[model samples]
Each structure stands twice: as structure tokens, then as C-alpha cells.
Target: MEVFVARSHPVDTHVGNRLRQRRALLGMSQTDLGNAVGLTFQQVQKYERGFNRISSSRLFEFSKVLDVPVEHFFDGMGATAVAAKRKPGRPRAPEKPADSDLNTKRETLELVRAYYKIRSKSLREKTRDLIIALARD
Candidate 1:
């Protein structure tokens, strides 16, 4: 079956390219990644080709499965490191957060699973409010 082409952002293209590059860097074949993700090789091909949309759940799964940070897939876009560092209205030098404390795929995947278990919408909202409040201070 032929995959359909839809309108895409430059960032989408960048993300797909990054996925393919990282797979190649790890010496993983499309079939291999497909097996890891319980997909057919053709499906993996479609994703890498940017003909299919990868859902956020799949993206999170991929990050853990690949043992990379979620941002690693979008690490170097048109935005430079310095650009990513600067948020509006923040005059101080951007403090870089350390990379993942959990190194292995197992650890990363476990953390992701736990994160999805939070049950309270109010808790999520409060957490978000607190984070934004803290960041602004």
C-alpha cells in the first residue's frame, strides 16, 4: 500500500530524520525497531518516511525503548542550544537541566509507566501551577 502525503511542518521532518539517524547510529534495522515496538517493518518505514503520524504515547514509548531523552529526537533543530535556553522574559542566564538520571531502557520505560498512573486531574493541575509559579520566581 502506498502511504499518503499530508502537509507537514519543518519540525516534523526534522523529528522523523532524527529518528532515522538515531536508529542508524545504533546499527538498528527498520525490522529490528519494528520488532521492538511490535510493529511491522512497513509501519516503521511509514513512520520514518513521515507518511504516518506518531502519537504522543508512541513517542514516549519510543524514547524509553531507544534509551534516549524525549528531547533527543528534536535535539538540534533550527533552534540552537542557546535559543532553546532562552524563554521570553527570563533575563537570567538559562540554567541547563542535567540529562536523564535513569540511563537504561528499562529504567526509562518504568518511569514512563509510573508517570501515566497519576490519577487526579486536580493534582496534575496543581503540579502544573506550582511548577509555573516556581519557575517565575
Candidate 2:
């Protein structure tokens, strides 16, 4: 007996493009990637052309062979588009912190301003003591 399977919305074309792009970025030829992923250059060509469907097990194997996260294949797509492309639960990078949260040379500027404002050594010493105390974690 034999079993049959079918893909509802085939996305191998897009996956193939991504794979080829990443492979080229990694400086790998189709034959080189085939060697790494345990396929012949012809098979790699088929995959790149969307003439073949990649399985989950084979995808994991490819991830191991290519030294990349499985999620690397799918990034920056719509909810439906990505779901159609691959499995559920793709990893997401964190949101960037606000500009106000990142400080650069702010302390140096504050110190220079305070130093220029103070004329007496005793006042500077008091300000330094207060700054050190405030800085204590």
C-alpha cells in the first residue's frame, strides 16, 4: 500500500528564493549546499525552483547542515503569509528601547555644567559627594 499527500497552498517557490539568497550570502553554490544538505545539485535545483516540497524533518536536517536557525527561513511576513510558508511559532526580536532610554555622554555633560556653575572648592566637593551617593546602587 502507498499513502498520498498534498499541499494546500504551495510556497516552495518563495522558500526556494529565500534559500538561494541565504546560500549565496553564505557563499555556497547549489552543489555546495546540496553537499551540506545531503542532496544532489539537481535536487537542490528542484527545491530552488519550487518543484519539490520540503518536509519538516528534512528542514531540521537542513538547519543543522547549514548552521542556521530553522526560523531563519521565515522572517518579516504577514500573519497569513508566514503561516502559509511554514510551521507555527516563529521567533521574534524584541522591540527597540526608546531614544530616551539610551543615554550617551549625558553624565559627562551634566558634570561639566555643574562644575562650571560652582566657584568654591567646598561646593564642588559637596556636589561630588552627592553625585557619588546618588550613583550608589
Candidate 3:
């Protein structure tokens, strides 16, 4: 007899990362997202952490609320992440070193929001150029 142990799929993690990125970029809180989808914030957290697999209908609802296409959640997912499905009673694939996803960071989101709030086109360009120059050092 085989037992099925639930594990987070790499695809799910990728989708969750995208979900978090989009939500944060739009300045939406987990509570805000939950209320829009009729779920609690904890449920939203679980979804964002890939602990809960979102249903297709729920995903559609999220897409609608987030003002994104349904395909957005799968953006940037590699073929290896898609192919590494977990089987019943099988150990999950070893996690690869993830590239630093700046979009998923709260600091990055805050910085982006603050940058847009500058409101002057030339000032924004100067700020961007300054940051790029600083990064090159």
C-alpha cells in the first residue's frame, strides 16, 4: 500500500511567488485580497505560501480581482518546475537555489510605490538613473 504525502509543488511555489508579486505591486494587502475572494486572510497566506493549492475557479476569481490575465500566475516558470511533479510516497525534488526575487520583497514593493509617488517625470528618471549608477559601483 502506498501513502500520499502532500508537499508543495515547485509550480505552486512559482505561482504563489507571482501572486505575491502582483498583489504587492498593486498595493493590495492579503486581507484585501481575501475579502475580494471571500476567503480569510489566513487562507490567502496559505495560498501565497503554496501550502494550499488554489482551485481553477478560485484562480480565475483571483485573476479577475487582481486585474491580470489568468496566465500571469504562470509567468517565468521554467519547464523543470513544471515537470517536477511529486508522486505518491515519493520524496520531493531537491529545491534548487532560487534567484533573488526582488518583486516579492516588501522593501522592493515599498520602494517602487514611493518612487511612483514622486509624480514628476524628470525627477523619476533622475532617481532611476541615480539608483542604476549607485548599483554599478
Candidate 4:
């Protein structure tokens, strides 16, 4: 007889990635998020790693504490990941999207945090232009 063991859903992974990104962007530690959401840091770590699924109510609470809309967690998830949430068994691996590169990189996140910290809009724009020009070279 075959035993059916459930694996982590792709949507769950995507949500976790979003959660981690948002938390990092805010410079919040796992302990900080845990305290805000009434959970342990280990629980927050599990959620961020997609080792456990997040309940809707719990997700809503996280959204409130993170200062983001509930939909934010679902952002950038592909159709395959969304569909996997509705189906029962293990899902097929998804195709990698080109733009997903930046999203998965620590450097990109750090750059984003630093970019937002720039107080002057003109300076930010100039910096953006410089980066674009550098990227073309």
C-alpha cells in the first residue's frame, strides 16, 4: 500500500517568500514579527520557510501586523501555484520565470531596502537612472 504524504504547496512557498521579503524590508526580526503576531520566533521561522501552512485568520493577523493587505502575500504567484492550492495531491514543478531571479536574491532585497531609505525623490531617480545605465554596460 502507498502512503500519501502531503508536501508543502507552491502557493504556500510563494506566500512565505512574500512574508519574508516584507519582514526583511521592514527590518523586522523573526522575534519581532512573532511578538506582533503572538507566536514564537520558531513558528515565524517555519512560516517563512514554508515548512507549515498559514491559516487564513492567522494570515489576516499577519497582514495587519505587517501593515500590508492580505493580497500582498499572493502577489507574484503564478497561475500554477494558485491552482496547486485548490488541488489535493502533490503538484508538478513550475517553470522558472526570468524575472524571478531578482526576487530570490538577497542583494536585490538589500538594494530595495536601501533604495526606499533615500529621502530625496530626485536623488532616488538619479540613482535609478545610474543603475539602469550601469546595467546596460
Candidate 5:
């Protein structure tokens, strides 16, 4: 008998992070995402944690539910990770940016959600301008 173990790939982890990021940005709970995807919240959690790999069909469904393109999940992944999957040799370390943590912050997500909730386009633009000016200062 042969035993096999499933390991989480870096790409999978990156996809999961993107999933969580998109979900959070939409202010959707795991239960909300699960209901839309026809899965339990626990299953959603598993996917977000990279404990289970998501199928292409499942990812497509998620894209529809999350109102994002399927490419969204792979947005920030490095070329090395993609090549690593195809080559299937020793895992290469992911190249992470120093400011990567900024994008994953709860405060950043909350700010983005709040910013998008402004109904008026002019107001949104003005808010964006204000933020940019403040950031530059």
C-alpha cells in the first residue's frame, strides 16, 4: 500500500489569500460566500486556508459570486510560483514585497470598503484625491 499526503502549494496559498482579500473587501462573511458557492462555511474556510485545493469550476463559481475576474486570484503571484508548479521540483521561495503586508491589513480593507460605499462618483473621486494628497504630505 502507498500513502499520499496533500500539501499546500504557494500558488494555492496566494490564491487563498486573494480569495480572503476579495471576500473581506466585499464585506462578505464566510457563510455568505459559502451560501453563494453552494458549500458550507467550513468548506469556504478550508479553501481560504489552503487546506483544500479549489477546482477550476469551483474557482469560476467563486469569481461569479465574488463579482471578480478569475484572474483576480492569481493577480499578485510571482512567475516563479507558476513555473514551479509546472516543473515539479524542489519548491522555490516566494519573492515577497516589503509593502505586501499593507495590502492585507484590516484597516486597509475597511478603508477600501468604506471608500467604495460612497454613492456619489464625485464624492468618491474627491475622497480619493484627499487621500492621495494626505498620503503625499
Candidate 6:
């Protein structure tokens, strides 16, 4: 008899990271997400951490709630990640450092949230233009 332990796949972690990024970008709390999905915040945290696998249906639900397409979760994944085949007893590849991605940064998310909260469309456009102009300097 063989006993198998299920390890988290890189795809799962990637999806979880995307989920966290989207949630943060929208300024939604874990509790709010959990309430929408009929889950506890702890469960949401587990999903965000890739400790629990998300089902297709649940992922669809998340897509609806997050106002993104299903493909959003899979976006930015490399071909290597998409084709990963892990063997038992083999060590997993090291994950990229959390700080490596600008999108995953707390400051980036906060800035996005604040920008959205501006309410006035023209103000938001001007704010975006200002940031872009500043970056070009």
C-alpha cells in the first residue's frame, strides 16, 4: 500500500497570490471575502496561503466577486509553472521573494485602493496623469 501526501502545487500558490493581490487591490478584507463565499476568514487565509486548494466552482465565485475573469488567476504564470511535474520525495523549488513583485506590495495595493476612492472620474484621471508625469521626470 502506498500513502501519498498532497503537497501544494506551484499553480495553487500562484492562484492564491493572485487572489490576495486582487483582494488587496479592491481594498476588500479577508472577512468580506469569506462572507461572500460563505467561508470563515481563516479559510480565506488558508486559501490565500495555498494551504487549501480552491475548486473550480469556488474559483468562479471568486472571479465574480473580484470582478475579474477566471483567467486572471492564471495570468503572469510562466510556462515552467504551467508544466510543472513534481515527484514524491523531491524538494519543491523555492518561491520568489514576496518583495519581488510590485503588484504584491502593500504600498502598491494601498495606492490603488486610494486612487479608486477618489470618486471623481476626472480627479482620478488627473491623479493618474500626475503619477505618470512624475515617473517620466
Instruction: Tell me, by TM-score, which candidate is best.
Output: 6
Candidate 2 TM-score over all chains jointly? 0.48
Model 4 lDDT per residue over 1-137, tens place: 65666666777878888888889888899999999989999999889877799999999999999899999999888777767654455455654532365775678878998998999999999999999999999
Model 3 misplaced regions, further than 4 Å: 1-5, 96-99
Clashes of each: 0, 0, 0, 0, 0, 0
Write model 3 residue lDDT over 1-137, tens digit each, in one string.
76677778888888888888889888999999999999999999998888888899999999999999999999888888878867767776567533376667778888998999998999999999999999999
Query: Which lDDT tens digits does candidate 2 get at residues 10-86?
Result: 35655555565556555578899888777899998877656687787877876777677878655433355445544
**In model 1, what are the clashing residue pairs, if there are any?**
none
Residues 1-137, model 1: lDDT tens digits: 65543433445545666676667555578898889988988987777665676887787777787789889877766653334432344344332222221322344444444445568878766766776799799
Top model by lDDT, which number? 6
Residue 38 local lDDT, model 5: 90
Order of the predicted models by TM-score, top scorer first: 6, 3, 4, 5, 1, 2
lDDT minimum window of 10 residues, candidate 5: 86-95
The CA lDDT at 89 in model 6 is: 71
As for model 4, its CA RMSD to the true structure in angstroms is 2.9
lDDT of 5 by residue, 36-83 (tens): 989999999989877788999999999999999999999968776676
Show the colliding residue pairs in model 3: none
RMSD of 5: 3.8
Report lDDT (Cα) of residue 19, candidate 4.
89
TM-score of each: 0.51, 0.48, 0.85, 0.83, 0.81, 0.86
